[model samples]
Target: MLHLLTPDEIFPSLPEVDLERLQRRGVRGLVLDLDNTLVAYGGREAAEPVLVWLREARAAGMRLCILSNGRPRRVRLTAERLGLPWVESYTKPRRRGFRAAARLLGTRPHETAVLGDQIFTDVLGGHRAGFVTVLVNPVSRRELPHTRVVRAIERLVFALLLRRGRIDREAWRLRTS
Candidate 1:
């Protein structure tokens, strides 16, 4: 059960994700989370770096879409800013959201990758949907109260993984590069 929640890859941030490597691995589409995955929660738009990365990924023939649990208005605003399609109030960790995202990208689940900051939601949902799952550190510490509780549990899981040597110390560190 816990294993299902584990991410296939872990990065400190979106920029640290090796898009080229993903492309090489035959990932043709991306299902990205909005808050904390692409930007800090409540951010109105993606940062310049993120926008550039998305453009490059698209140029490389990767389809992209934002799938988030946020309200439609918020999701639409962010998607419009990044010029990407989106599905809002996605109710993640549910296979429906993942399936919807894959459909939007015009790809099969196995050929798509899902990136986000949560394990129970993004990772679990992606894994359940048979998509490659990447977990990134949250961009900001500020999160909803419920998410804070989940973060505590995530920290415990990380500690256990560290102790068992399932992951390296670097996995817990925020990577700037």
Candidate 2:
């Protein structure tokens, strides 16, 4: 169970992710979380840097999809603004959404990477679905009530991992150049 929640990589932000490195590893697709992962919670649009990265990633021949648990309208609107496909109101920590995102990207699980801010939902779901997982710090501390509760648990888990030296806090905090 703990292993399922463990992310394969941790980064300070989405922009820090090395798309070229992922490509070298044969990751041809990306399944991204919408809210804190790409922008602040309740944000209706992607930030300029995110848009630039998305353009670059697409140009590099990577398929992308927004897989989010947000309301359908919000998700769809955001996706349209970013000019990307999306699966809204997706129930994470469940394999179905991850699988569906993979299908939408036209990539098998092994050839895809799931990037998000939540460990329990994004990491667990992606791991369970056999996709690589990248966990990024949330863009904002504000989140939904239920997500706040999960964040508490996530902190505890992160503390334990830190104590065991399984993760490097400073390394994960390094800002992208």
Candidate 3:
């Protein structure tokens, strides 16, 4: 049960993800979380570095899809700017949305990776769907009130996981390259 919340990999930020390493590990597709993942909370567009990372992934022949819980118009606009397909208002932590994103990417769960900032949502849903899960630090300190509450719980769990050695420090290092 606790393992479901554990991410397969962790990166300081989205741009820090090593595309080459993911490719070597058989991740041919990516299902991305929008808010505080690709874009900062309440931001209109992805930063230049994020854009570059997406471009690099595309150039490497990786399929990408945005699965956002945000409003339809916001999600659609962001997806359009990113030039990626999207599943809007996709309540995360649900297997349905994750699987839908996988189908949209035309990739099997094993071939897909999900990247996001929240453990309870993105990591849990990705694990439930049998896709590789990557967690990144939230791009902004600002977030919704409900999310702030969840973030507190996330911190506790993360510490416990670290103390118990459930997190693989070596795998964390492996991603740096």
By lDDT, who's the top model here? 3
Root-mean-square deviation (CA) per prediction: 2.0, 2.3, 2.8
Error of 2 at 38 (Å): 1.5
Better of 1 and 2 by lDDT: 2
**How would you encode candidate 3's per-residue C-alpha lDDT over 1-177 as one tens digit per residue?**
889987888888999998888888899999999999999998988999999999999999999999988888999998998899999745688889888898899999999999999989999999999999998988888999999999889877776676678786654343322
Question: For residues 11-52, could you state the per-residue lDDT of candidate 2 as single tens digits?
Answer: 878887889988887899999999998879998867787888
Where does candidate 1 have its weakest 10-residue lDDT segment? 168-177
**Candidate 2: which stretches are off by over 4 Å?**
169-177
Clashing pairs in 3: none
Please give me the total number of clashing residue pairs in predicted model 3. Answer: 0
